[model samples]
Target: MVSVDYLTKPLDIFKEMCRILKPGGLAIMSFSNRCFWTKAISIWTSTGDADHVLIVGSYFHYAGGFEPPEAVDISPNPGLTDPMYIVYSRKLATA
Candidate 1:
């Protein structure tokens, strides 16, 4: 099984995943919500944990090579101020 860290650009990782996945097979990935207070604190504090990888909205938009992802709020009462977001996406056909 191939696993990559979230610090890697989402697009590059997605591209590689597309290459490895069997046709019609599904790949699952998780991204960090930049607005999450915990992430902010970690960054400000610089805890230096290897898990501290920042994935913001723009990363998906530009560096990550993804468009608007199909999203569902697992959390109750999702508002603009909410700090965490969970997104799920699937790879389309490869050219």
Candidate 2:
């Protein structure tokens, strides 16, 4: 999936990412200020792009097996086009 806005159970997806990744593996998920609004979840459609970053980050944090995720702004031109962002988390390394 290109975006999590369409996910009905995003946290569950992240949990599975953690479960399947080897220690220290990175799991990166990205989103933008764009999506199929009708298909997106209510919260995603209701919130703005900045909030979208936080929402996606929460999926990683609450999923329970990854390091804190980072949200990066990668929009090509601030206002010229749709804004894009990425939230990535690393699976915690096993000792």
What TM-score goes with each of the models? 0.40, 0.94
Error of 2 at 71 (Å): 0.8
Q: Which stretches of candidate 1 lie over 4 Å from their true place?
A: 1-6, 31-68, 76-84
**Predicted candidate 1 versus true structure: per-residue lDDT over 1-95, tens digit per residue:** 11223233546756665566665445544333343344344432343222322333233334332344444344345554433334444444442
lDDT of each: 0.40, 0.86
Encode model 2's per-residue lDDT on 1-95: one tens digit a residue: 46789989887888888999999998888778778888999999888988888898899889988898998888899889888888898999961
What's model 2's TM-score?
0.94
lDDT of 2 at 77: 93
